[model samples]
Target: MALRAVVRSLSELCITVGVLIVLFVVYLLYWTGLRADSASDDEIARLHKQWAAGPVDGGAPGGGTPEETGGSPSRGQDTTGDGQAGGTAERGAAPGTARGTAPGGYRSGNSFAVMYIPRFGGGWSKPVLENTGKQTLRKGLGHYTRSAPLGAKGNFAVAGHRRTYGDPFKDFPRLRPGDPVVVTDGDTWYTYTIVARPYRTLPSDTGVLDAVPAPVDEAATPFDRPGRYLTLTTCDPEWGSSHRLIAWGRLDATQSASEGKPDALTR
Candidate 1:
């Protein structure tokens, strides 16, 4: 009788452990994603509301001067909130300027733009927040602080999560050359065409954020000259960050927000 009792207790304990593990997995995979998705949507809506209200203090329609908006760090510094300090490109244009105008500032942790990838589907859009910190990425895609502004003449790099935090870039592997990644700063719509499929590299390969990312090999060279570019980065293996995945693109076109949505988004 004692042996049977012992066996029964062990069985109950094993079952309890199994149940707890399942709940943890659900929280990580489902609950966290739901929360992140809602947060991203809220950020997008906030940006739209700000834009509709018009530019304040002569800044971009939805932006303000860095002093007023709590701007990010200057160029060549670690604005990503990550420990690395590598980017050397020119500072991003002040927030809220049309193409060809002087660069504006970015309020760290704030959403300055919205990105839509038709390849990801018409319903897919994510807020592009400043600073690629751990907490910033949980809200949406995080822009590399020192990279160029949208449609600017330098590398405009952004990062997102692959498996959690709403899995914004879970489809990172599906992106291909010729795909379109459209972004808007409430004043202009910038369309970028993917120059090649995703590139995988070590997390230490900060050159990918340079004014012009160096080609990994002779045959895979994407850009050889300075120009406006787009880069999307995420973790590899869907559930692991052992490697970094990247996608590069060039500014294909730009249209004023007054002109209606870009064709890349309409079609």
Candidate 2:
């Protein structure tokens, strides 16, 4: 009887494993559509040129014309600047060497340089840019809809997973005040300083990705929550995404070339 019971237990385990593998394959198939591999050389150069020219208001890279999606956090001015700070949540860590955040956050179709958190490790090297067509989840930093362009004005919000899907925000818990976060437009590298790591509710009913952050603790700063605030959001509890983890960083404006770990060819 004991042997029979043991055999049955092993059989059940095998079945469960098989089911998991099949589900995983399906997930990969769905996620495959999210990648951008067929970019044209001309398009790449154009995006690079835009980044070199500094922030532009006449539609971002591949922004089509201009969108008017309402996303003003405070001013109610349809903020969210024109840039790619997309989102798509994945649970498991991505396979292979991680790519550094590049073309950083372009306006879809338009390539933008992405500054990654090298200190944050492989999981954070490349941030998954999201699109506006789907439900926003912060799997990666989302680009601004229209109006507030990258390096221009408005809030440049971004999101990531803290414990799964490579867990970009794994070190988010350790990010101290004044940590550096650089964003390049190919030519100029914009800098951001870590400020705070706060939290909000699920789905973020409010305009969490606004032109600027909602007054947290009534802290005062230049430009009225001004300059650029790099908002990073992730799941809470670290096990399951029960709540959301939010953090804010201010743009330094003064940009320089990026020279750090994760050299070229790592991409």
Top-TM-score structure, candidate number: 1
Clashes of each: 8, 21
Each candidate: RMSD: 6.6, 12.5
lDDT of each: 0.78, 0.47
Candidate 2 TM-score over all chains jointly: 0.52
Instruction: Give the per-residue lDDT of model 2 (tens digit) for 111-227.
Output: 334556644654344432433332332233444443244455566666554653334466767766666676654534667777754554465433556666553334422235556
lDDT digits (tens) for residues 119-178 of candidate 1: 887799999988899989999999998888777788999999998889899899999999
Q: Which ten residues in a row have the lowest lDDT in candidate 2?
A: 69-78
What is residue 123's positional error in candidate 2, in angstroms?
Answer: 10
